[model samples]
Target: MRNNYHGFTLIECLISLFFISLFFLMLSGVFSQSQQIFQRVESREELEWQIFLIQFDKITEKGTFRDMSSTALIFEREELHEGKVVTLAIKYSSNKKYVYLSNNGGTEPILTQVQAITFDRQGDAILFTVRFLNGVEKVGKWTIP
Candidate 1:
């Protein structure tokens, strides 16, 4: 009796297959979770960047620099309402953690979760800074005659 069997036993093959399947299953789960995390991060970053841009764009238009402080800005915008000039007030409230724009006796918030806002002037350039709740900051500049 010379049985020269050179193949894996049925039980051994089943065990190997089970382990391989488990490993691949775990790998796919980890990859899927990581993908979700990455997507969320990307979306948050885009939203943060847009918050900065929208606030700055709103203020860069033609307006009289009535006054400004470390956390607020007051200006008379060159906008017309009912065939009359209008002035708008813009400011960042640390207490509420939001930026507000008010015009014609109406007030509304523009952005939220802002930690700070500052304005400065150098030569012909008006500079502004915005700080977000996550400790991120953005600086913007506009030239004025």
Candidate 2:
């Protein structure tokens, strides 16, 4: 007598299950790593923002207003070397998606991924509004001293 069964044996079944679980384990690890990378990127962007704010505060602290518009803030500060006043302009370029700092005739971009900026005078202060590319908005007041 001969008997035939078309089915997986216990060892075969166990091996297949183990391989499937291993695949899932690797997949979960990849997912977790991706999440960690995203979190790190987010924190780095926040750090960049903090640095930008510190630089902006330092530049505008004792600056005298020269001119201001919706897209630019021009100011003058005395040079420490020769007692000569130098013109500085903070300009937001919608086309370039950056905030530029221009000293005298030289220009350099200071902040990036900016959408729009507005400067308005309020009493003895300047009310500034910044709109970021990700739809975040910041409003602040800078008083001239």
- lDDT by candidate, in order shown: 0.75, 0.83
Writing each residue's lDDT as its tens digit, candidate 2 over 25-129 gives: 999999999999978866765776677778778778757777888788888999898899999888988899988888879988877888888888987888888
| Model 2: residue 88 alpha-carbon error in angstroms | 0.7
How large an RMSD does model 1 have? 5.9
TM-score of each: 0.60, 0.72
Candidate 1 stretches greater than 4 Å from native:
1-42, 78-83
Model 2 worst lDDT run, 10 consecutive residues? 41-50
**How many clashes show up per model?**
0, 0
Task: List, residue by residue over 1-145, the lDDT tens digit for candidate 1.
Answer: 9999999999999999999999999999999999999788657856865875677566656567676666666777655556566777777777998778877798788767678888787877768787778677767776664
Evaluated against the true structure, the overall lDDT of model 2 is 0.83
